[model samples]
Target: MINMKRRTFLKGSVAAGAVGAAVSAGLLTPRVVLAAWPSAAFEAKSVDSALDALMGSHAVESSDKISIRAPDIAENGAVVPVSVTAPMSNIDTISIIAEKNAAPLTAAFKLGKGAEGYVSTRIKMGKTSNVIAVVKAGGKMYSASKEVKVTIGGCGG
Candidate 1:
């Protein structure tokens, strides 16, 4: 390995340390971090409230076209894998909701133009509840759900 001069090493370390300290102290935050987060929706206690806050209304049309892929029983509720597939064009947004969670609005994703109508991620669940997938497409809201039994609670159970 090429030896690094003491001066060079010290300079590199100082720069890294300075950047780290600035970030930790909230002094050098990038504007793009947590951009356009639906804070009110995420903080909503009830699923209906969350849906209303996030999607303007909870009234959705049940559709077989949307599919939610998840395990029937999640051994660890802390990191349950969930996948949503809405094989329809003009999809605008996809959201995942865990009905029993304190903050029932687990995750939401906005799809760009012509983007795939699919989203996959892990979400925490407090208990056994229905995992719902809501999709907004063509100025309409469609949804589907599947019950997920959590053997071990994830939200501080």
Candidate 2:
């Protein structure tokens, strides 16, 4: 006779519950299970090229309505904090572009219904570059950018 222990199915359920909590708290964006991921857009080398691939023929205008809050100087090129906030109606997506990175597009957020038009995340900077925040709302694209100087030590004294 052999005795087998019961599987920890509750543990898996707990993890799923945690993900639900994160979605409710807006900490993480839930992705469509079978949605196709955009590889070419994120793999584009230049900012303009990436934008063209993502937004097609649409014009991107610089707007004061979009605010990009990033450190004027980032001590580390490996991790730079970036945040974007816009008080606009019908926001569809927000994308963060690290202008000088090998792959310029760093993060793209697809805002769901009732989700606040704000996104904050840490991105890698290959060197000193302008971080641009692009927002799509009401069939128009608005953008803002800030230059962040990367330091050597990666930790300010």
Candidate 3:
């Protein structure tokens, strides 16, 4: 038989009940938990506009320090694997952009101080286009791009 203490069980029950009430009352939403959502950046229609909205500037330097790993040809454009690796220091953010998508900015990730500059995720490709990786480090923006061919369109061909 397992030993269970009455006081311990009551404490856990109260904690759980408090959490459940907070959630049910919509007090524990994503916006409240996480950082502020960048709606303008995500809603931008063009790649340049998205970059401008996110990074506060559209001009980005092309750099060899950033590497993009993605398939040259995607069989299903719906879920194409993409990864970005930047072995540079002071990486603030990493953003993925699909050149031909209606809203070019696919994903953006914020990194903490002293964090490794690596982000991997699957993104939807509207058609055959360039997959661009923009890295923000030390208040400067650097970018790298690779062409990806999509066999089946994902975003409303």
In model 1, pairs of residues that clash are none
TM-score of each: 0.73, 0.74, 0.74
**TM-score (C-alpha) between model 3 and the true structure:** 0.74
Which residue runs of candidate 2 sit more than 4 Å off their true CA positions? 1-35, 155-157
Residues 1-157, candidate 1: write the lDDT tens digits: 3456666556645644554444446553323323568665676666666666666567799999889999998889888999999987898789999987767889888898768999999999888999999998888989999999898634533
Which residues of candidate 1, in runs, are more than 4 Å off? Answer: 1-35, 153-157
What ranking emerges by lDDT with the best candidate at the front?
A: 3, 1, 2
Candidate 3 — worst ten consecutive residues by lDDT sum? 25-34
TM-score of 1: 0.73
* Clash pairs (backbone) in predicted model 3: none
lDDT of each: 0.78, 0.75, 0.79
lDDT (C-alpha) at residue 18 in model 2: 53
Question: Residue 124 of model 3: what lDDT?
Answer: 96
lDDT of 2 by residue, 21-50 (tens): 544574533234214565545655567656
